[model samples]
Target chain A: MLQYVLKRLGIAILVAVTVSMITFSMIYLSGDPAIALAGETATQEDIQNIRRVYGYDQPIVVQYANWLWNALQGDFGQSHYLKKPVADVIFERLPTTMLLGACALIFALVLSIPLGVVAAVRPNSLIDRIALTIAVVGQAMPSFWFALTMMLWLGIYWRLLPISGTASWANFVMPSIALGYYITPAVMRLTRAGMLEVLSSDYIRTARAKGLRPMTVLFKHALRNAIIPVVSLAAVQFGFMLGGSIVIETIFAVNGLGFLAWESIQRADLPMMQAIVLVLSFFYIILTFLADMLNAWLDPRIRVM
Target chain B: MAERVLEVEDLCVEIPIPSGMLRPVQHVSFHVGQGETLAIVGESGCGKSLTSLAIMDLLPSKAKRRAERLVLDGDALTGMTERQMADIRGNQMSMIFQEPMTSLNPAYTIGNQLTEAMLRHKSVSLAEAKDRAVWLLEKVGITAARSRLGQYPHQLSGGLRQRVMIAMALMCGPDMIIADEPTTALDVTIQAQILHLLAELQDEFHMGMILITHDLGVVARVADRVAVMYAGQFVETGTAAQIFDSPTHPYTQGLLECIPIPGKTERGAHLGSIPGIVPSLVGEIRGCHFAGRCPYVHEACTAEDVSLRPSLDAGHEYRCVLSPQAAIANRNKQAAQ
Candidate 1:
């Protein structure tokens, strides 16, 4: 187990390095950073002076190395747009995004797993058909559009849940649901497929023959094994939600890092945007790494190999 | 005779395919009494396993099972609610399937699975359930029973897993057990050991056991009575001695002939075999199901479907146009000629 953990950590570090390189270059290499920093009206001499001051006059490689070195110590340059440290800007907004992402993930699992299990247990039944339809429809709609309509219908007309902004749990209801439903289809589909396969296994038949209640057999015998593959998938999905919550958060006014990312992009805030992408990608890598380990622990067959 | 434990009459299982409905098990009827072993012997895809599943009401969702009278311990089970059946299942009857490795859930420790049945059916405390699990583990011949309880199915060898499976079936003290080719996936030596243990446990508990297999030697060794299934139907059933010694149906005869008798078969000579495959079970059928494959292909054999006809001895029955005595005499005449 220790060896496995060590090997995973090695991979994690390699992935972190790769992600930081790509994010750093993608943001820095694309446009005129000096002009963007000094404004379009600046004279050539003024631009050159600004470039020298910000180290944009330096070679791209040197600049990247210097930037990476500073990032290692939590100084991702200053966010000129936010008038604060990049790390501080990101950390200030991290809590809201994490809360929304966590809520959405919980909602997705709470809804998908049972629906998937039911659909699998009684395939082609009414409940199965309804769940399938909901999943398919949810997957078809654009997230921003879905969020808009849901806000209109539930928050405006029905007056059930608050439409926009992160005021309270009620304020979270729309965006959380919008983001939750985005991944629910994939989770539900996998759960149903996994449940169907597990239900037919010889072990499940043995479980049934044991005279266990249908629910007991479905949950204990079938679900535990079925959820092994789904856990890894959920982890990947959860990672996506952390970063992918951008669209839903923007539409619903749930002030999180997603909104910050959009604002940085609009204003061309290079340092803050770079920090957001790098940290989010690093988080994505970490999530996937944890998911693989969780799967290995759950299924010993994979563990031994 | 011991009290009758399971009585299944005219059980039929049909699955609808794109072509039509496939009759996988049709008009199969048999009964098992306490302390008795009824081996349903047939080649693969001959509906032996389906018949066992039908008895347990565990048929796949696409397949439909119907029986005239499915009774266990004197209670009717023909249309029992899934909830009611749950109570009787595992409590009164449990099943052991082929491939013990795949029959035990990998995620659970052996103790959890073993105790689950007893706890589910009875109000036994967890401590009592654990003790029973240890006792059963020891009974199934596993050493270090208490420690073995903590291990998962993947930790055990195939032989030990099979033994654990058998022990699991006995957890709730079920009156009947349907072991579907329980030893087929194990090594030959392990197979013998498992059979011995299963027989010992069955005898000790006096449970009515239905052993489904294709091995004639296995049937000869363990079965008290035998039913020879052929393509979704039983063509022959009788006491094991009668089926082995005085087989009647042509299909049953062909099956028996396929088995090599040691020292009797000439060295390097081919053992007996039946020609042709089992006929398609789709659509309507007007004649004998085995007509295409039987060696004695009479026009009358295919003219009409056949039902099980009894011999002079009670319960000795077969599905064929010719009587057992007449078929034997006919064979004798052919030899003389």
Candidate 2:
């Protein structure tokens, strides 16, 4: 087990390095950061001075190496758009996005798993049809569009929820719904397929023959076996949710790293953009690694490797 | 005489097909007396498993059943809701299926699977359930039952898993057990052990058992009465001795002849063979469903449908147009030559 943990950690470090390099290189690809930082009205000397001040006058490799070295020491440089430390800007916004992602994940599982199980147990029934319809609709609508529509119906029309901004726990309701709706279909479909397969297995028949109630057979026996695949899918989905909150956060005007990243991109704030990209990428990698470990724990066959 | 424990009468199961309708089981009737072992013998798709499922009311909802009566210990089972069926299944009439490897849930420990029925039917605490589970494990011949109870299904071998299934089935002390080809998936040695264990358990518990299998050897070893099925109908049924020694139906004769014994002649030396497969149940049949493959096929055999009638013995019965005396005479003449 120790060896396995170490091996997984080694793989995670390699993944993190690859993500960092890609994010850093992409930020530099726009070229001539000095001109962009100095702005259109600035003289050539001012541009050169700005380049010197930001160390953009150095070689691209040297700049990337220095940026990476500073990042390792917890220095993300100053945000060009926020006019504050990039790390401080990110730290303030991290909680809201985490909360939104966590709530959406919980909602998706709580709704989709039972729906999928019912649908699978009684295929072609009314409940099954309803679940299938929900899955189709959930997959059809984009997150941003869903968020806007929720905002319109609940915020503007009914005045039941805040239209934009994350202020309190209640404020997370609409954004979480949008995020949950987008992800629910994947969970529902995976759960439905997995449940159907497990339901047909011989053990379920054995459980039924054991005089277990249908609910016990389903929830305790069938669902436990069915959930193995769903756990892995849920893990990947959760990781995606953590990283894919950008569009939903932007639409809701939630003060999150995603929103900050969008604002940084608009102003061409290189350091802050690079920092946000690196941080989000790092988050995605970490979550995926955690998901892999969780999956291994859930299924012993996987742990054999 | 043993007391009658289960009686299934006129049980029919119609499955809807895209092209037409199919009756997988039609008016199949059988019963098991207390502590009696009845074997429903048939090749694949002969409705043996369907009959077992119907008795338990475990058939899928798509299957349409029209049974005159299905009584277990004088309790009616027909038309009961799934919840009610759940109450009776493990408590009164439990079942063990073929493929032990797949029959036990892999995610759960043997102890958990074993105690599930006990917890479900009886008001037992966790400690009581666990104790019962360990006891059952030991009863089924698993060593260190307490320790092995924590092991998963996949951790056990096929034979051990089969023993676990038996342990689970008998955990509730059910009055009857429907073992559908219980030994078919195991090796010869394990199969023998399981069959012996079943016989011993049946005696110890005084439980009526219905063993469904295609193996004549299994029927000879365990069955008191045997029902031979063909094309969703009973072709022949009698005491195991009568069915093996004096098979009345042509299909049963052919099936017995097909079994190869030690020191038997080389293959294809006039060895018996049933010429055709069982007919599909899609369309209606005017005459005997087995007439196409019966060596005694005559115009009358295919001209009208045949129903089960008693042979020479009161309990011995078969579904055929031929007289029992004639069949016995013909079989004797063939054996003599």
Candidate 3:
């Protein structure tokens, strides 16, 4: 087990390094970085001076090495627009994004697992049909449109929730629903399919013949095997939630890393954009790694190798 | 005679398809006594497995089971609620299924699944359940039973897994066991070993057993009484010796002819076979179900419904229009040729 974990960690580190290299080269891909840093109205001498001061005149490999060295030390240089360290801006807003992502994941799992299990219990029954309809609606409805609908109903008319901001748990209600609902259909459909397959398996029949209570047969015998793949899917979806919260964050005015990304893109803040991409990619890689370990622990067959 | 453990009378199972209601098991009834093995023998798709499943009340949701009487040790099972039935199941009666490769749950340890039925049906502590699991595992002939309990299903071989299944069925010391094709999925050598183990266990526990299989050799060796089923109904039923010596029904005669008797059948010669597929049971079935496939099918055979009639031998019955003596004479004449 220790060896398997170390091997996974090695692969995760490799992916992080590759992502960092890509982020570093993105600024150079769009014409000259000096002109962009110095502004369009700057004279040629000012451009040359900016290039020299920022080490743009150095070899590309040398510049990349220097940037990587500083990034390793948690120093991502200053944001051109905010005139503050890029790392400080990111760290300040990260907690909000993490909180939103975690809550949305919890909500999605809590709602979808039982729905999936019930739907599979009696296929084509009333509750099964209702669950399937919910899954379809959740999949078809766009997140932005759903967000706006919730804001109009809950925030403007009924006045049930504060639609915008990240002040308290109440503030997260509308935004989390909009973000969490987007992935509910995928998780729910997977769980339903898995449960259906497991329910028909010979072991399940043996479990029934053993006269296990309905709940014990369903949850302990059936659901335990059915929930393995769902765990990995949830991990990958949580990573997407963290990175894909840009549109929802902007609409709700929750100043998280996604909002910071939007602001940096509009103002041409290259250093801040690079840092955000690098950080988000790292989170994605780490999450996938954790999912693999968890799956191995749950299923002994996978741990044999 | 030993005390009756399980008794069924006029049991039927119907399933609805697009065409019509499929009566797979029609008016089948039998009884098993303590320390006795009643083998239900038939070809594939002959409702042998359905009979056992119906007794367990584990039929699919769409299928319906109706029985005039289903009693276990004088307790009526027909009118019992599902909760009450569950208490009886795996406690008073248990089941062993075919396909040991998939019968045990892959995610659980042998000890967990083995102890589950005992713990659920009895008010036993966890430690007591574990000890029972170990004892049963050893009883089924597994070496190092204590260490084997910690292993998952995939870690064990198919034969070992089947032994574990047998051990699990005996965990609660039930009065009756319904094993559906228990050794059908095993290798030839392993099949004998498993059967030997099962017979030994039944003798030790004196539990009534309903063994469902399609192999005549298995029935001859293990069964106290044999019921030959064809197309949803029993064509013949008798003691093993009576059925083998004088098979009165044409279908039963055809089945006996299909096997290669040792030192009797010619070497490298074509073995006898019962031609024609089993007719569909989707609609109203008239006369004998095997009329179309029987060689001696006469006009009067298909004129009306055929029911079980007593043969010359006491306690032996077969479904046929021909007299028992006449049927036996025809089979003897055919063998003489």
Global Cα RMSD, each model: 2.8, 2.7, 1.5
lDDT of 2 by residue, B98-167 (tens): 9998998777778878887898899989899899888888888999989997777778899999999998
Superior by lDDT: candidate 2 or candidate 3: 3
Residue pairs clashing, model 3: none
Task: Give each model a TM-score.
Answer: 0.92, 0.92, 0.97
> Fraction of true inter-chain Cα contacts (below 8 Å) kept per model?
0.82, 0.75, 0.70
Residues B15-102 of candidate 1 have per-residue lDDT tens digits of 9999999998989988999999999998889999999988888888789998998999999998798989888888899999898889
DockQ of each: 0.67, 0.68, 0.80
Ranking by TM-score: 3, 2, 1
Measured by TM-score, the strongest candidate is 3
lDDT of 3 by residue, A1-305 (tens): 78888999999999999999999999999989999888879999999999998899999999999999999999999998899999999999999999999989999999999999999998999998998899999988889999999999999999999989988899999988888988999999999999999999999999999999999999999998999999999999999999889999998999998899989999999999999999999899999999999988888777754
Best by lDDT: 3
What is the docking quality class of candidate 1? medium
Instruction: Show where candidate 1 strays beyond 4 Å.
Output: A31-52, A55-66, A158-162, A293-297, A300-305, B16-21, B312-315, B330-337
Please state the Cα-based DockQ of model 2 relative to the true two-chain complex: 0.68
Instruction: Specify the poorest-scoring 10-residue window by lDDT in model 3 chain B.
Output: B328-337
Q: How big is the RMSD of model 3? A: 1.5
